[model samples]
Target chain A: MSADRPLEKLRVLVADDSPAMRGIVRAVLSGFGCDRVFEAENGLQALAVTESGGIDLVICDWKMAPCDGIELVRALRDPARSRDPFLPVIMLTAYSETARVREARDAGATEFLAKPFTAETLYQRIAAVINRPRPFVRADGFNGPDRRRLERDHSGAERRQARQS
Target chain B: MSQAKPYEIINPPNKLKAKTGSIPAVNPEAIKRAEEALEQVKSEFRNWLAEEVRKLERAHADIHANGLGGKHGEALFVVAHDLRGLGSTYEFPIVTRLAKSMCKLIETAEKRAAAPRALVDAHVGAIRAALIQNIRSDTDMVGRELVEELERQVIARVGAEG
Candidate 1:
């Protein structure tokens, strides 16, 4: 609960079909000092909000109708359609399987939070995106935040060469 | 890099604005107020859960009467999934665990027509019992044992079919 936490100024959008889930997320964001929290019932609505601009972070559910979290992330990362392709998107889902996590990551989500998450866990994620923002990657196959979770000291030349090859 | 099109303009405009360079400080009073609101929401958990249980019960009946693979099965999965995610947040860890197990049971069932009715019933029953007995903790020995038994049954049934 640091007074200078980065979450205080963030305008977060929480997208979920369940009203209860949306309320809980808004409450958690409020605890983090986020005064401007918006809600979307599905990915379609979430996309509209994202397109309208000014959304710093998105916390989206996986199993929404008309559009799911993966579809939303893909749309946001698409250079032709995205308003802010670099916007941090966090996928909040109950499906903790490897396949689902991979799908979310490949679709350009900045982070993945499993459902039944604690308040502390949520805080840590928001902090991660704020304090330690990742450089966005725009390679032939990938167009989102860097997917690497591990930190290493590879040389800049080596990294660029690796990406090119 | 290509510039993306601006979003469609909505009336009254969205209230969310871009962040300034300096992060705002956390207000202790705001945190306290949010916590109070959360507590108020939790206080109404029993009624909400009861309503979910009724929906689940109806879904179960629909499945039994008309068989699975229809809207009833889908409804059952949706409700169970919601319970799985919300139970722990609302201080009902046992419900979360049970509902998670139930979700898996439904997910792995080979065919809708072949769903294990007894196993589904056990899970639904355990959820109701957990709420009635106020079994909120996953560490509760009785609750743990019940969950394990239900999981074992589901695995065995699915295994047998496979």
Candidate 2:
């Protein structure tokens, strides 16, 4: 997690249908010191790559042929199908609407970066996923990282306070 | 600040080395490299942009050749979506705005039919103009006026049809 080497020794996956987008993402990943970057043209391919294992993070586009990012996330979070359900995922898309953001979040995305994003924003999201790892949550209807940014106990005290004692 | 936690995946085909406990610092050199790579992509965008514009033109021609409502209209939607996604990234913010407006028009049109010919023409024409003129800034007066006029026409057309 060292800021100086955020992506050191990590394997990342970039999934998108556009060759241009894939190249750009790969370049960005390389700049971040992630040398072992894998590329997949669609969600299905991404799933296959993830299943093969060794990937530390996934950066996926929202739209693609055969399968999409949301579908990919759903499958990845499914304990029956996922190789590593705890793997961090960042969803990228041109659509920045509230509905799109909510859809990705509900689908278990670790981070959301809107399209036309700068390297700084991309790096910030990567930092967030690595430095602020959220605990996974498994409920009857949902199986993914916890959605809440802040954690509180039943009595409304911060969960960290309980750990402090 | 809490100690940086070492996150590990329980199972992996190949295990990775444990990372240190500090947030990765933003490397200026990396940013520069990324920017340079993006610039290379941008340089190639002119060809891509030209191709997309040609597709738009052909689609428009097809609509004229085979009447309205057909595969051509769908093609316009696809092209507009592409432009909307790529324009700003390729340093053509105005094109993005115009294409997004065009998408709204094509999307809101009744049925899967081609949008009103005049509106479609206006949107296509404006996009071509923006690209040819190399209007990169969203606030450029001419580009802003062109977008506003196209938007106005689209709204009027949609309203009349509704």
Candidate 3:
């Protein structure tokens, strides 16, 4: 597990009306070594960013004046418009009410971060979401000293399994 | 009237006070840019607050039409709490003060076991008046200062009355 994985180019969108809150988020994200961070003041602006594409993740506050984080999530997760419907969204909220949290989760938020969270919490969450491996599987049963031996053994086994399936 | 408290009184466990300073952390040029950005936000925030004040007026009018206590009082408390929190955050001291007073009135109504239509209506009217005053203001700084003075007077009067 090298620290320098190829996640440097990932773009994250942060939506919060408070300049103070936005600054804290940007500082924390930068501390995590993420280079591409975009910000929006409200859900409407966040929606525009999503429409423009290339955003890997969205972290939004739930209580903007109008068209809040839930509405934002609905718009971004809309199958009709999005290139990827399961775009992981993390919602930030000051209110820690259980019912509201459940409502946000039901509205398609992948994660919820309560206000006044730490930098460590923020980084841990981003790392967990972004580091998920794509589906390309390989298995080797034999002990091989070199690459050629491992490839020969795995390829032979994979072909046999593919034929059986 | 019901025996319900209006304010949440979040003690923050460790009492995490907000940091204040005479100068900003960013460089002079960066501070200038931040201020410009903040000015834009301030304008937009003022409009948003004005819109909320109108909505608050409408909500109070509804309270008068249907009376307070029961579900209406509960809803009123929820909105008032929201106004207090956001108003304080954005430096709208008057709205926050007015909202706090309304919260107390609502709390009183709840504690009384039965809020009469007339008394409840009076409280609702006061809330509406404060909201109207908020929208007529020209700038946030002025609105905030005036509101603080108004709040002091209001709290004093409420104290004297009690």
Task: Kindly indicate the candidate among 1 and 3 with the higher DockQ.
Answer: 1
DockQ by candidate, in order = 0.22, 0.23, 0.03
Residue A142 displacement in candidate 1 (angstroms): 3.2
With a 3 Å backbone cut-off (N, CA, C), the pairs that clash in candidate 2 are A1-B22, A2-B22, A2-B23, A2-B24, A3-B23, A3-B24, A3-B25, A4-B25
lDDT of 3 by residue, A48-84 (tens): 8888887777889876746788888777656565555
Candidates in descending DockQ order: 2, 1, 3
What lDDT score is found at residue A52 in candidate 1?
92
lDDT of each: 0.75, 0.74, 0.54
Residue A4 shift from truth in candidate 3, angstroms:
6.8
Q: Can you write out model 2's per-residue Cα lDDT over B43-121, one digit (the tens) per residue?
A: 7777776776787788778867875565566666666766777777777878877887787788533633746677778
The best-first sequence of candidates by TM-score reads 1, 2, 3
Question: Between candidates 1 and 2, which one is better according to TM-score?
Answer: 1
| Candidate 1: residue pairs that collide | none
lDDT of 3 at B99: 65
